[model samples]
Target: MKIRCIAIDDEPWALTLIEKYVKQLPQLELVATFEDAIAGSEFLRKYPVDLLFLDINMPDMNGITLASSLINKPFIVFTTAYKKFAYEGFELEAIDYLLKPFDLDRFQKAVDKVEKAMLAAKLSQKSNDASIFVWSEHQQVKVILSEIMFIESRKDYTCFHLYNKPKLLTLLPLKKTEELLPSQEFVRVHRSYIVPVKEIRKIASRKVVLQSGEELPIGRLYADNVSALVKL
Candidate 1:
């Protein structure tokens, strides 16, 4: 898999040099380049990438601060002239540190490290697919999709009703939780409810009856979604 990347530096020449080095590596694909650290941080939040080449010292926001603020952080490679920040970079478990004026050989070494790290992460993610993990009660809770009967949304938090198990509550938005399940398996009948399509036993004009005899209201906004489910 090609590693999608973005480079951020205050200096125009620094950005150009990283762009050139990224082109030389076939395994890397440069998505965008930014001269401002804050702009780069905003882009990363909107779009997901596999790697980042960041300069340590920049105006507005520094690289380390930006990296720490990311919700879903990617692998980071620190590129700057200062060697004093080397210790701080390693503390964040950065992929590699490249001093300024480095040659092609040094750049290749950094890319090689990213390649190996990405491969390992891919394998680990595959192993984690057996159960989805969400934070609750100050710890991560593993949830099996098949065991989930239905979901009830209470604004910021969601309640998960599982078969023969206590309800699990997590601080996840209803819309965000919907994106985690297979589209065909989970159907949204209301703005605040999501039920497993397989667990639905009956559907009325304004209510959905599940196998457990639990009834949930069908919101007007999602009426069309329930109609489509009936056709299935």
Candidate 2:
């Protein structure tokens, strides 16, 4: 997992320390550097900065206030001279607070936080994004890729019942989606319904009922493949 980070510190030595530490980690990429928090805010608006090495006691605004201003705040690890504000930093949901004159081991702890946060986000995206892209009517539309309960042939076009989306009329045939998607997950239940095996609620002779309680007529031609799926 790669984490794009920005360093915001007023002191030149502090910035140098951050740069050296960031270079040591393969997973971290130093996206931007700022001498002050104000300039850093402008840089962030233009580019997406994932993790921040922020300084608390800047000349004008405090790092805590600046961090709060971001709508989608990055993972913050406060690097400051003041040790008194450590508890307050935690209140901001900072990944870690690194007091000035901290060692390389302490810096690695902050980098670890970024790695963990990124892994969680990737897992969430995989679980939530069940949609797939398709070209339709000279435009592109995303159909719930997993919600494709079944597909049916309509002569030239294949109607994919991705439920709640006006039946996705694709130029490709029923076998196209099946071939593209995992074959182990989908089986041709009937000449019409190429049902996702996971969505099949129950199977009866001649027909298989889907989770939505819709009965799809199973064909004799596809019976052997359907029977193999049920055994697995």
Candidate 3:
């Protein structure tokens, strides 16, 4: 199923970039583009959308205020230059908050998060629930997709942190751990880590901070992804 999205940004170049990215992704259909939040609101009210690529710093109406005014909300993915609003976006229940100047690959990664969530939601609705067969203490444990956060790797052993209770630890290398996790949502952006794309807070030059306020070093090998992400 395609994700119908509408791009809204005050800047012409930013809107154009979003348009270009939308055209390239087969799963994303561009329903419309609006320079102001007012026009976008009218379009959205008349026609429902699956996703919205929103700009936070619009002149007339901020993305946050626009989102708050609506009773019905589609999946929101915020785009902004400032990192200060990252926490607020997440608190507002945005699916993903992407910083400005993002590249195609990073954009793809963001879309991947949305797709994964949608797929999981559909599965839940159909009784075809999503499950992950994970290695746990010399045994395999089945985990619900919604129960996970991130895996903390410890030399040849990895601990899977779930939503409740103590985390599950298993014998697995970082590379092996990376391979086992879902590629769309889980990424090895650091050497000793695999993080959920939706869990990220912001990316500075050398490190990425999680929404939980924990910091992880941006590895040399992963620098390209970081660079590409910031460029977007």
Query: Per-residue lDDT of 13-97 in model 3, one digit per residue for the tens?
Result: 9899999998899999999999999899878888988899888988889999888777778889999999898888888889998
List candidate 2 segments past 4 Å from native.
130-232
Q: How well does candidate 3 match the true structure in TM-score terms?
A: 0.55
- lDDT score for candidate 3 against the true structure: 0.81
Task: Give one digit per residue, the lDDT tens place, for model 2 in 163-202.
Answer: 6667888786667766766566678877766887778999
- Candidate 1: where is the Cα deviation over 4 Å? 129-232
Q: Encode model 1's per-residue lDDT on 24-136: one tens digit a residue.
A: 88888999999989889999999989999999988899888988999998999999899999999889989899999778899999999988888877755664464578888
Among all candidates shown, the one with the greatest lDDT? 1
Q: What is the lDDT of residue 171 in candidate 1?
A: 94
Q: Is candidate 1 or candidate 3 better by lDDT?
A: 1
Error of 2 at 28 (Å): 1.7
Error at 109, model 2, angstroms: 1.4
